[model samples]
Target: MTVSPRNLRALWPLAPCACTALLCLCPALRGRGAEDGAGCGPLLKGSALLLAAGAGPPTLLVRPRSDYVCCHLALAVRLVPALPLGDALYLVPARQALWALDASKPEQRLLAWLRQQAPPDSCHLKCLQILKGLRDLSGRGLEGPLGAQWGRVLSSYALKTALFSVLLRGPWQAWQEQFLVERLEELVLYLRDCLRKRVLMHFFLGNPHVPEAVPVPRFLREAAPLNLLAAFDAATLDAAATQLLAAWSQAPKIIRMYSGPRHLRRSPALCRHVPEASQEAQSD
Candidate 1:
């Protein structure tokens, strides 16, 4: 019988739940050299996060000001436990936010340290934010044809990998020099290349495609190759690519610098064509 993610989450009380699933599904996070039973059979060293936006808790009223709406359920590989789930808990996301609190705390010291060491206001984030917008627009268009569950070709996990790859290629100051339009163009160009090449190497997998400059720590390498884009079993790649190009071509050229609060976001106008879906959560 095929067990859904919801079914798996239902078994959380009986087992380690998401942690166990990660060990079984992702080669990088299974059977390693670490203590046994806290979650996995042993300590898995994989750095990838296999967060899926499943039909889990929807429209969760996290606080008065914010209603925590999960786009999907999450299944983080090695990092969820190592990084502490709280900070990454925003939402499983068909395309949405995540709160870091969702991570487990016991094994997150190193991951937390690395996060602190990253440049707080780096251009990497600036460009990443735009790419995220592009993804949201693309996903919005896909809600119907691909169905709510399988609409997107790219996931937040994949976008972060692409952004980190850019960071690896640079003198950080160089990004600041590029205009916002240039940044978008640069990112879109690279993504288009990845799509064409059919390779978006998992950052933590020690894949042959990972850039040498990226500098993934040895401990984070899971010794298993996990392709981040394996989620799509449909023709979503071509569809998403078409949406991306259209969005890139039609998006307004924002003149504001990456350093400010004044700006207008642009895209292929996914909402312009598709009606918004109801935000109701899946019922058990």
Candidate 2:
């Protein structure tokens, strides 16, 4: 259950299988790493610093267009063949100030609990499709001139976590087509409240409401609930709240834009294949 710093190098082989490349998280930023410059400003404006495995002497600075850094991630699988679930726990770099000096101590010094959860139930695919559509539209500037402003404060993970929380508390039948609009409204409202309160708990950690089947680490079970919003500074938080309000007012239009006649015209077969089509287009 514990991986030494020396063996951390073994993880590199596995990285390329999942993503195009692996990037290291900055030891200085710890828990406060953002994908792009967003609101972090000039510090990440030009390049992302990726430290090599050992003593941080030789570093690689990638000048991606986004101007934000990626995080250090170690993948862990909790396989139970008999169960219907396939849970993956990602040991991301921790935020504690103490671990700021070392990136190699992933297992002991810098491990945070993040689970790649399975869908809540059989009904979740429809919910995921709806969520993914909203996200795709938002990236296309449905929420603002660019998604960067809101992206600075609110992450897609936060939104997904919120959606999962709702799914867990569901009556199961509320996910029907007739209640789709209401569900969307509720999800938006829930996110709005999280933005207002500046606290969104990670759905898997320290949650007793989670079913017995989901495997949570013992330390995380005892640890205080994590606030996903904790990374945002006061100014960025205020800006996020303001932008969310503006977006909330335009929610109807945004929803219409996504579920409108343009999308409605697509057959179920085409709709299901959107992810592949979009990926192929992106590659072109």
lDDT of 2 by residue, 152-270 (tens): 35555677677777766676677555455566656766776787788888654566665655455565556566677886666666556554544443344454554554433223222
What TM-scores do the predictions have?
Answer: 0.48, 0.46
Q: List, residue by residue over 117-222, the lDDT tens digit for candidate 1.
A: 4554445566667677656654554555543533335666577667656655655554553344555566776776676566676665545554444444453343
Candidate 2 pairs with clashing backbones: 36-68
Segments in model 2 whose C-alpha atoms lie over 4 Å from true places: 1-88, 92-149, 248-284
Best by lDDT: 2
lDDT of 1 at 100: 20
Question: Would you give me the overall lDDT of model 2?
Answer: 0.47
